[model samples]
Target: MLDVRASLGECPVWCSNDQSLYWVDISAPSLNRFDPATAINTAWKMPESIGSFTLRKAGGFVAALRSGFWLIDRDGRLERKLIDAPYDSTHHRFNDGRADAQGRFWAGSMNEKRDANTARLYRLDPNLKLSAMIDDIMISNGLAFSPDGRILYHADTPSRTVHAYDFDETAGTLSNRRIFIRFEAENDRPDGAAVDREGCYWSALYRGGKVVRISPGGTLVGEYELPAQCPTMCAFGGPDLRTLFVTSARQMRDPEELARLPQSGGIFAMRVETPGLPEPRFAG
Candidate 1:
């Protein structure tokens, strides 16, 4: 059985080199690191909301803030600003993001009120230049890349579909968009995802209390149920890459719902049969 604890955790990532699992508590403005071997957890607080983050090449992390991306140290130190993604017409904020195989950082934006198509997907290159990868999205959320780096998966919350794109590894471009999977009727919405070595995608359902395994062809293969309803994102970690770490949210639940699901905002864990790919590094 998987045992872990986190409140309002949003981005769950695995650091293979360190054999540690790192994630963020968005509403609480904190970052947590769990060492499975020591069975100990460490946390650091930040002054602002953090949408997502990833391991850096040298050390530390690249974090997404409400207005831009910044380099941060392990002690919650602000190294420097990298990119700015401010929306004028909407109260949109950065949500989920990850790095591609080439190290380019990609993330999506979403409206705080869940209204309008102001959210967008952005790509930041090593040169520190930012550009729109996709635009006019309702609520840009999770992201994933295929094993061969030929396919990219994205989700727009309102549409409730994870869309796939034909990706060009050399050019860093996307085309041929199509629906990858449609969530089951009662499964809230698809939030975040991670792709495995076999090209299967594991996605977290926002209000369903489950992490689903969907094949490359968009077929449902399995489901890992959780005690929380707002599972946000998931990533595989460990020496053998068999451990699955998940993040959850507590923003939208009511009192009655919270009473029944006290673990609603905590980070969760499980062991999966298949191992996952190393999280791609951000080129910038």
Candidate 2:
């Protein structure tokens, strides 16, 4: 229900306990929350770009900022620096990420140059330990997990493909990696995504102007087109978790594209027949 124009809108999260929706503006470098009941919007300026975050069980947020991962207070103030930037900030910065079911934070970096393969995916354990997972990635995006937590979904935007990995939920290990989807169009790429209770993967196809739902078997089942060409991400909200909230991006968009879709960076919502799985809270 939020129409706030973000330069680069991403990471729409539903905090059911608080009955609020949270999201981020990477180019604006801010964190925002909205209350549908009161139509109140709250924002906090971040020190650097924030790619993604997860709600904490202790009533705050654990986020992946360009500088590194940090614990943020409820009022959106920095509470603790969980860890320093693991990669060289001059060439790399955090792009997209989220938390796993085991309470471990997962974030990946992107090469600002766009052509370098000097990037990797990292995981922050509950104890605040950092470890690199996938390496040599370019423009990492679309981080998500399947409903049963048995599959981990990720994407390398430059390659225009989404990958599915056989996951070991208990150990947080990924194997048997396979191509979940590949775009034949050079401009169509996967961005952010979430899973539904039916075990279907809903992907926000950036520049494709639609959110596509694919069955667990990797079959395209449904597609919802949007006004914006760059829908960054989507998450389910509302009491029954049947409302799907989508965030789009206007940053770095061409002027002609922005003119056609005036509300390029605004947040939109739609009611869905199936309820989405609840986003998990970080135990640490």
Candidate 3:
């Protein structure tokens, strides 16, 4: 684990071009990068809560902040807003998101109060157009696409259910939404996730403190426990792409738990046999 930590660490992305790891601290509202070679850590403050982000094919990054999707330059500058947030920021904010293999940016909203079904999943096209993909979400997390781009997986954290949809890659449309896997316990709520080259899903079980590798057919294949009380997300990094890095949460956790797990907010890594697919760049 890296010595650095965050209150709410999530949305880990491996920039193979740079051979570094990029992630965000939702509570800290900052973007951070870690380079293993030099053991260096860097961060840039965000104006608002950043739920998630993706690298643009051309340059810089596209991020889903509380305000909306915006372009971020290398020097940590906001170039411009692609579009205003679809929902009211007073009660909601962007959460987990990523770019599909086709370069479509997909981000889902999170309901702050967890009372109403006001959340929705959004897709930003290459032309900068925005559209809704799904709705009635309590907490949107675990957004991932299959290796072939023919399947889409998402989850509602509070619902403890991870769902899969038949994806029309050509049109970027979804159909046949079905329960991919439903957690039977409250602590096993699914959070952020990523897919491997073998077309399998690996999800970070939030309070359950473990990452689960599920088959394409939604069968549990493997489970790896963590030292933290909450594992927020996981992504593949390193040159060989065999290292699985996981982010965790230290914010809002009990004091006793924090003391027991001093590395709660720190990033942890492990080696895996199956490699992960490269993070897709935003086409827009």
Candidate 4:
């Protein structure tokens, strides 16, 4: 475990080149790099809350911050502003995102006020073009793509449902949206997710205290109980991509609860049988 104690840790991405994990503390508003070998974490404070980010093909990162999309260099310097926040920055911000196999970046926004379904999903092409792909979303989360790149999985956290879409990697589009999985338990709110090479979708249940593995056919096949009640996201990393790293949150927790779960905001990891696909880099 990496004991960084983040406030709202999310978006764990594996950096195969350096054999390290990159993640963010949304509430802390910082970018972090964790090295498993040394158990050392490096951080970069951000001007605004950073929702998610992915490595760039050339170098550095393509991030979705509260203000908008940006190009940040390896040294944490903002290189350029890709676009302004498409929605009102006061009520909405980018939440979950990743790059597709084709090098296109996709991100979803969330309605912080929760008063309406005003959030939307967007796509950022390699040429710096931005487009809104899906709309009427509340809390956008659980963004992952199948290994074959033909399916995209997403979840609206407050709705407790995960959805799948027929993805067109070439044209960078989605179609035939359908319910992939729906949680009946009140605590099983789907958050961030990852797809293993076997096509199994692993989702971190926000308040459920566990990560569930769902079969490609939308069946709950396995589960991994976590020490923290609020695991925000998970990523597969390590030498062979067999280590499943999970990040959790400590924001707003009662003092007693925090004492009971001291590792509430720390990063945890475990071995897994099926390896995960290498994270795709933003081509732009």
| TM-score for all models, in order of appearance | 0.94, 0.97, 0.98, 0.99
Best by lDDT: 4
Q: For candidate 4, lDDT tens digit of each residue in 30-61?
A: 99998888888999999999999999999999
User: What Cα-based lDDT does every candidate model obtain?
Assistant: 0.82, 0.89, 0.92, 0.94
Q: Regarding TM-score, does 2 or 3 come out ahead? A: 3
Regions more than 4 Å wrong, model 2: none
Clashing pairs in 4: none
Better of 1 and 4 by TM-score: 4
Where is model 4 more than 4 Å wrong at Cα?
none
In model 2, the Cα lDDT at residue 248 comes to 95
Tens-digit lDDT string for candidate 3 (197-240)? 89889999999989999999889999999989799999988888
Give the range where candidate 2 is weakest over 10 consecutive residues by summed lDDT: 1-10
Give the per-residue lDDT digits (tens) of candidate 1, residues 1-284: 12343446777788877788888887778777878788777878877778888877767888887868898886668889886665752477788998888888887888877667878898877788888989879778769999999999999977788999999987889999999998756666989889888999998988888899999889999988888888999998888888888888777688898788777777677888889988877656
- In the order shown, what is each candidate's alpha-carbon RMSD? 1.9, 1.0, 0.8, 0.7
Error of 3 at 40 (Å): 1.1
Tens digits of per-residue lDDT for model 2 on 64-105?
998899999999999988899888898788988888888898
For candidate 4, report its TM-score.
0.99
* Candidate 3 TM-score to native: 0.98
Give the number of colliding residue pairs in candidate 3.
Answer: 0
